[model samples]
Target: MPHKRAKRSIRDAETAKKGHNLAPQASTYDDTPRSASRIFNAHAVQSAFRKAGRITSEDTGERKPKPSSSTNTSSSSSSSKLKPQNGSSSSTTPTTKQTDPKKPAIPSILPNESLGEYNRRVEEFLRPGVSKAIKEAASIKAAEEAAFRREKKDRKKRTRIERLVKLGKMPQAALDELDKEMKNKAGKRKRGDEDEGSGSDDNDDDGDKTTTKPREREEKSFKPIEAPRRLNDIVQAPPSLPHLRKLGQEKKVGKGVYGAVGKGSGKDPLNAGQRRILEEERERVVKMYRDMKAAREEAKVEEKGAKVKVKV
Candidate 1:
C-alpha cells in the first residue's frame, strides 16, 4: 500500500461499526470545503488490465480492516481519535450481548472448518502447483499477446500497401522489382558464403581487374541512348573502341552482346508477355509525346497573346 493511505483514515471510524459514525471533524472554521476526489470504479480498472480478481476498496487502502472484536466501542476521550489505539496497557473486559449463535447464511457452501486452519491446509495442498501454473499462464499470455501484435502490424502493412496500389502510388511492377531484388540479394549472399568457404580470391581479382579496366570508365564513354553528334557516329566509330560504338554492348561472341550478357537480360527468359508489353509501352510513349507537344503549343500561343495585350 502507498504510505499516504496506510495510516488510519476517516473512513475507518465512519464504517467500522453499524452504530458508529466519525467523530466531529476538527479543523479550522475558516476552512472551506475541499472538492472531493473523484471516485473511480475499482472493477473497471481491474478489468482493463485483465486481472483475474476484482479490485476491492482494500486494494486501494481506502477501506481499513474491520475491528476483529464484533462489539460496540465504549464512549471515551481516546475514542475522539481517528483510529483506536493499539497495545493499550489498560485492558478492560469488552461488554457483549448474550445472544444465540447465528446459523451459517451459506449453509453447505462453506467448508466445515475455521478460516485460518482451512486456509493453511488448502494452501499446503495446492502450493506445489499453483505458483508454477500462474507463472506459465503469465508467460503464455505474454507470448500470445506478442504474436497478436506482430500479426496486427503485418496486417496493417498489407492494408497500407493495398491502399497505395489502389491509389496508383504503388505499381505492380514495383512489387515484382522488390521481389526480384530480394531474390538477387539472397543469391549474392549465398555465393559470398560459398566464396568464403572455398577460399576463392580469383573472382575478387577479376572484379578488381574489371574495375581498373580503362574502357569501362565513364567520363569518355558514349551512351547509346544519346543522339550522335554527327548523326552517323553509330557506324562511324571503330568497333574496337567499345565506348564510341554503342556505349556498352559489343557482340564479341555467341548470339548475345557483351553488355546484355552481363545483365542476364535480368528479365524472365520464358516470358511471352514481353513483346506485348513492349508494344503497348511504345504506343503509350507516342501518345504521351503527342499530348505534351499539343500542351506546349497551346501554352506558347497563350503567352504570345498575353505579351501582345501588354504591348497594346
Candidate 2:
C-alpha cells in the first residue's frame, strides 16, 4: 500500500533537447496529499528513455566520463554529500566495519551459513583444545589405574610374608629385612636368595666332611627280570596252528532260542502287570504278619500285667 503511491515507467518520451541521466530518489514521509500522490513528468520520462537507449547502444556499462565539463560537476556533487551530523537514517549507503583483509587463525562464521557448516566451523576452531583435553584425561586415568594395580600387588606380597612369619616358616627379622630392602636405583640391590643357597651348600659340605663313618656299602638285593624259558623256546620254535577246544566254542540253537543264555523253555512266562500285582500282595502279606505279631505282644503284656516270673 505504501509503495502504491510510487510509480515508475519508461514507456513514451522524446529526447528533443539536451537530456540528463534519470535517477529518481525514493521519498518516505508521513502521508500527505502531495506525498501520497503519483506524479508523471515528461522531461523525466524523456531523460530515462535517452539513458536506456544510450546504455544499450554503447553496450558497455562501464562508460568513461568526458573530462572537461563533467569532471568538475561530479567532484562537486560527491563532495556535497553531507556526513551524518547526528543519528540520521537518511544515508543510502550502509556503514561497514573496518577489518583486516588477511585471514584470521580461526575462521569466522558466515552470515547465511547452514547448520552443518556452522558445526564444521566450530570443530575446526575447537579441535585442538578438545583433543588435548581428552588425551590428558586418558593419561590421568591410566596413571590412576596403574597405581591401583601396583598397590594390590604390594598388598598380596605383604600378606604372603605375614603368613609365613606367623607359621614360623620364615623368621620375623627376615620379613623385616625383606621389607626394608632398598627398591630404588639409588640404593643397594638385594641378593638374599643367592646368599641363602650358598650357605646351605656350605653346611651340606661340612656335614659330609664330619661324617662318623664312611657310608656303608650295602649288598646287592635287586634281581633282573627275565621271561620264562618255555616262552623263549616256543617263540624260537616253528610256527604251528593252535588246537581247537570243543567246550570253548559258542553254541548256536535254531529258531525261538532265548539268546545265548537258554533254549527259550528254561524259565516260566510272566508279564509286567502280573509281577507288579505279586509285589503288592507280598507287601500286604508282610504288613498283616507284622500286625499279628504286634497284637500278640499287646495280649501277652496285658495278661502278664507288667510282671514276669523268672524260673530259679
Clashes of each: 0, 0
lDDT of 2 by residue, 115-136 (tens): 7997797788778888989998
Show model 1 residue runs off by greater than 4 Å. 1-119, 173-312
So what's the TM-score on candidate 1?
0.20
Error of 2 at 197 (Å): 44
lDDT of each: 0.62, 0.64
Estimate the TM-score of every prediction.
Answer: 0.20, 0.25
How large an RMSD does model 1 have?
Answer: 34.9
Question: Per-residue lDDT for 257 in model 1?
Answer: 53
Task: Enumerate residue pairs that collide in model 2.
Answer: none
